[model samples]
Target chain A: MIPDKAKELQERNLKYAQIIQDAMSGKREDMEKRIKELNLASTPKEVIHSETSIKLYRFIPVKKKLHKTPLLIVPSLILRYYIMDLLKGHSLIEHLVESGIDTYLIDWGIPGDEHGHLTFDYYIDKFLKRAVRKVSRSTGVEKINILGQCLGGTIGVVYTSLYQEEINKLVCLTTPVEFEDAGLLSVWTDRKTFNIDKVVETFGNTIPADFIHACFQFLDVKATVERYKKLYNNVLDENFLYYYKALDQWINDKIPFPGEVFRKFIRDLYQENLLVKGKFTINEKVADLKNITCPLLNIVAKFDHVFPEKSAKALNSFVSGPVDYHIISAGHVTLVVLFPQREETFKLISDFLKK
Target chain B: MFMDPAQFGKNFMDPTEFNKQFYGQMEQVFIEKMNEMIKNPAFLSSISKGVETGLDGKKKSDDLIKKYLEKMNMPTREDTSKILQYLQKIETKILDLEDKIEDLSDDLKNLKKEYGKSRKTEKKK
Candidate 1:
C-alpha cells in the first residue's frame, strides 16, 4: 500500500514537473500551435463535379489496379464531409483508397440563404442524380456502389428506392430508416410537441447552424462537458491532445440543414413515419424501399444515441435484396472517427465493397 | 516526497483516475435524468412555447430592420436571394442549352458523314 501510494505521488509529481518543464522550454506553445495546425482530412482529392451547394470529389487513386465499381461516399449535411477522411491514419477514405476501391464523395457545401428553398426532392432529383451520373460517366461504370453515413444514408436509401438501376450496392452507416423509433429526435420533433411550420416561417431559408448546435448540446449536456474534461485531463499527452483538438474542431463545425428539406425530413419521416410506410415522395414519385433490389450493407452502431440501432436496422426488413447487416459495438461518432472501432468499420466496408 | 503512513495507505489509487470514474458515473446519471426531462410532456410544452416566443421576437425585429433597410434603398438578404435565384435559373437554362448544343453538334457530324457517303456512292454510279 505504501509503495502504491508512493508510486501515485511520484506520478503526480512527475506530471507537474513535466508541465513546468514544458512551459519553461516553451514546448507547450509549440504543442498548442501544432494542435491548431494539424492537417485534418489530409487525404488528397480532386473535385470532379460542382453545382450550387454540392461538390462531388474523387480521391486521387493510391493503387494502380482499381475495382470496377466505384464507391461514392455521401456524408450527412449536418457537418463537414471530412469526417470520412478525418486524420492521416484515422481516415476511412484513406483505408478504402489503399484497399483499391475507387472512392468518390459528395461535399454538401455550406448552404447560402438562397439555398433555403432547396427541398428533399431537389437534392435527390437534381444534385444527387447529377452526382451519380457524373460518377458513372467519369468512372465509366453503368452502376456504382454508394456508402452513405447518417442522414446521407437516408438520402442514398431514398435515391436507390427511386432509381434502383443506378446503384450496384448500398451501404448505410448509423443511418435512421424508421424515424418513429429515432429516440429523442423523434420525441422532440413530434407534431404535438414541436411547431415545425412556425420555426420554418421564422427562420426563412434554413435553420441556423447555432440552433442545430444548441439542439446537439441539449441532447446530452453532460457528455458534451465530459469531452472537454477528458481533454483537460490528457493535456500533457501530445497524442491524445492532437486527436482531441482534431475531433473538437469537427464537433463545433455545424451546418444549417436546408429549410424545406428540414421541414420534409421532420414532417414526412419523423412525424408521420412515412419513409418505412412507403409514402415518402420525391419528384412526384413515391420512394418504396422494396424498389431497392440492389445488395445492401446496413451498419448500425450498438450504442448510437442519435439514431438507435433498431431504427437503423429497419432498412433490412423493407428491402427485397440481400442484406449484410452489421451492428458494431460503438457510439455514432466513434463508429467512424475513433480507433479500433473505425479500423474494424473500415475493414467491414472495404471487404463488403470488394465483394 | 515525504508522505505520512496513514495518508499514504489511503492514497493507493490515483486521484485523477478516481475523479474520472466518479465523473463518468455522475455524467451518466445526469444524462439519464436529462433524457427523462426531455420526454416529459410538460417540459416539452414549456420548451416549445419558449422557442416559438423567441422565434416570433426575432421575426418581428428582422421585419423592422428590413423595412428600415428598404427605406434606405439598400439591398437586403431577401433581395440578394431573389437575384441569386434568378441567376440560378439562368445557369440551369445555360447548362440545358449546353447539353443540347453538344447533342446537336454530334448529330450534325453524323449527318455530314452520311451526306459525304451518298455523294461518293453517286460518283461511283
Candidate 2:
C-alpha cells in the first residue's frame, strides 16, 4: 500500500512535469499551424464517375495481386467520405489497396436542393445501380462486393434485398437496423414528439448540417470536451497531434442530411421501425431482408451509442444469407479512428472478403 | 472491460468517462440523486426545447447568410448548385448515349448469332 502510494505520487509528478514542459514549449503556435494545415483523403484515387451529388472514386491499387471481384465502399449520407481514406498508415482505403483489393468509394458530395428530393429509390435504384454497373462494366465482372457504413449499410441491405443478383456480398458495420432500443437519439426522434413532415416542411431543402452536428455534439458533451482536453494536454506530442487533427478534420467535415431521405429515414425506420418488418418498400417494391441470398458480414460494436447492440442485432432475424456477425470493442467511428481498432477491422474485412 | 490506456486514464481523471460499474454506482450517489432533485423528465424537456430553438436559430442565420451573399453578388453554394444543375443535364444525355450503346451491342451480338445459325442451316442443306 505504501509503495503503491509512492508510485502514484511519482506518476502524478511525471505527468505534471510533462504538462508544464509542454506548456512552456512554444507549442501554441505549432498546434495552431498543425490544426490549420492538416489535410485528409491522402490515398490516391481516380474519379471513375461523377454526378450531381455523388463522385465515385476508384482507389489506385498499391500491389499487383488484384482480385476479380471489386469492393465498393458506401458511407452514410451524414458526413463526407474522407474518414475512410484519412492518411497513409491509418486509411482503410490504403489498407485495402495494399492488400490487393480493388476498392471504390462513393462520395456523397454536398447535397443540393435537387438531392433533397432523392429517396432510397433514387439512391439504391438509380445512383447505386449506375455506380455498380459502371464498376462491373469497367472490370468485366458482373457481381461486386459492397461494404456499407452505418446508414449506408441499410441502403446496401435494402439494395441487396431487391437486387441480390447484382451483388456478390454485403457488409454492414455498426448498422442500426431496429429501433427497439430506447437510446437518447431514438427517443428524441420519436414520432410522438419529433414530427418528420413538419421538419421537412420547415427546413424545405435539407436538415441543416449545423443542426445535425449540434444534435450529435449534444449526445456526449463530456466526450467532445475530453477530446479537446486530450489534444491540448498532448499538444507537444507530434504523433497525438497528427491523429487528433486527422479525426478532428473528419468530425468537422459534414454535409446537411437531404430532406427527402431524412424524412423517409426518420418516418419509416426511426419512427415506424420499418426496415426489419419486411414491409418497407423502396422504388415501389417490397424490400424484404429475407431476399438477401448473398454472403453477409455484420460488424456491430458492443457499445455503439448511435447503434446499440440490441438494435443492431436485428440482422439475425430474416436474413436468408450466410450471416457472419463480428462484435468489437468500439464506438461508431472507432473502427476507422483508432489505429489498432482500424487495423483489426480492416484485416477482418479483408479476410472475410477473400473468403 | 471496454477500455484503452488513454480511456482508462480519462475515466480515472473524469467521472464523465465513467465505466459501467462506476456509472451505476455514481448514478445512485450523484447523477441519479441530481436527477431526482431536479426531475430529469422536466430538465430533458427544457433541454430538448432549447435544442429545437437552437436549430431554428441556425436555420434562420443560414437563410440570412444566403441572402447576404446573394446581395453582395458573391458566389455561394447556390451558384455552384446552379452550375451542377446544368452538369446534371449533360450527365443525363451521356447516360442516354450509354443506353443506346448497350442496345447496339446487343443488336450486334444477335446479328452474329443469326449469321452463324444461317451458315449451319446452309451446310445441312
Candidate 3:
C-alpha cells in the first residue's frame, strides 16, 4: 500500500533514467563511429633511407629549391633520425630544403650480431669517415657541412677535431663532450652496476631494451604520459592524424646499441671524461677538440632533459674553431619538429651556413 | 467469452519457438545493416582514409619517441649502482698510482738537480 505521490515519483524517476540511458547509448555509438571513421581515413608512409647497414629518412618538401650546399645530418644510432624531419609543415628537413639547403641524413641501421665487434673507433674511422667522404665527393665539394645530434654530435665533434681538413662547417646539436657534466649518464657509467662488457659480449652488437628503457623512465615519467594524451586529444584533423602515426612508428622502432661501441662510450667518454679533457685517443692519434678549426655551430636546447645545457654548452670552451652557439628554446625533439622552434632553429642554421 | 480454436492458435504461440523466431529476425536485420556499410563506397573510403591517417600519426609519434629516448641522459638504476662500485675501486687504484707517479717524478727531478750540481763542482776543482 504505497502512497499515490510516491508511486508517481517512482514512475517519473524511471522515465528519466531511461532517457539518460538512451542518450548515453547514442553518445557511445557516436564515439565508436568516430573511431572507426578515423581508422579508415588514415594515410601513413614509411620513409626509411638505408644505405648498407645505415638507415635514415628525408622529408618531402612542398617547394623545391635550386643549388644549395648539401647538409649531411647525423643522428644518434640509438634512435631513428625522423624526429628532425617530423612532418609536412613542421619538418627541419623540409624547411631547410625549401630554404635552398640540400640535405642528406645518415641512418645508423639496426645493429645485429654481426656488428658486435664494432667500436666508437670503428664508427669514426670507418662508417662516418666513409659516409662524409662519399657525400662530399657526390656533392662535388671538398668539404660538406655536417650536423650531428646527441651522440651523433659527439661523434661529429671528434671527427671534426681529428679531421678538420675534410669537413667545412660543423654543427653539433645536444652533443655531450664533457661527460662529467653529463649528469645521470655520467654517474651511472662511473658506478658500473651494468657490466657493459658482459652485456656486449653476450648480445654481440645489441644492448638490451630493458636497460635503455629504464634510463629514460627515470626522467619525468608523468610528463611523458601526459604528452601522448594531449597529442591524442588535440589531433582532431586528418593531416594531424597522419603525422601522429608517422611519429608513432618511428618512436617504437628501437635498435640495439653495438656492444664494443657501448663499452667504449661508457669507459672513455662517460667514465674518463676524456674528449673534453683533451685526453681521448682514437686510432693511435690523440683526439683533441682544440684541433677543430672549421666554423662551428653548436645548438643546445635550453630545457634538454637528456644531454642537459651544461653538457652541450661545454663544447664552446673546448673547440678552437670559430664557434657560434645558439641556445634554442625547446626540448631535444622539439628543436627539430615544433612550429615556432622549427622557424627559429632553421633560420639560425641557414644564416650560419650562408656565411 | 467464446473462443474459436483457429483464433486462439493465431493469437498464442509456443515460448521457445517464438524466441527463436524473434532472435532470427534481429540477427537478419543486423547482418543487413552490416552488409550495407560494407558495400557503401563512401563508408569504405572513409575507413581506409582513417587507417592511413592513424598509421601516419603512429609513425611520426614513434620517431619523436625514439628521438626523445635517444637524447635523454638519465642513467638506469643498474648503471648508477655499477658506476658507484667502479668509482670506489678506481678511486683507490688511482690514488695509489698518483702517489707512486708523484714520488717517481720528485726523485727524477732531485737526481737531475744533484747531478748538475756535482758536475759544476767537478769543473771548479
Model 3: lDDT of residue A345: 87
B1-125: candidate 3 lDDT, tens digit per residue: 53343533543354433544565566567556654654455665565455446546755674676566557965543344456546544654674465578669869999999999999999999
Query: Relative to the true structure, how large is the alpha-carbon lDDT of every model?
Result: 0.84, 0.76, 0.66
lDDT at B70 for candidate 3?
59
Worst window of 10 by summed lDDT in candidate 1 chain A: A19-28
TM-scores, all models, native as reference: 0.85, 0.78, 0.61
Largest DockQ belongs to which candidate? 1
Worst 10 residues of 3 chain A by lDDT: A40-49
lDDT of 1 by residue, A1-355 (tens): 5578568667755765564354334233453453347788788899887777678999999999999999999999888777787789899999999999999999998787868767899889988887888899788799999999999999999999999999999999999989985888888898887888888888988888778767776666667767756655676678786787677666655668888988888899999999899999998899999999998999999988889998999999999999998989998889998778888899989999998
Q: What residue runs in model 3 are displaced by over 4 Å at the alpha carbon? A: A1-51, A55-68, A228-244, B1-125
Give native contacts recovered, as a fraction, per prediction: 0.56, 0.06, 0.00
Q: Given candidate 2, what's the lDDT at residue B1?
A: 58
Which residue segments of model 1 deviate by more than 4 Å? A1-36, B1-32, B100-125
lDDT of model 3 at position A90: 65
| Prediction 1 TM-score vs. true | 0.85
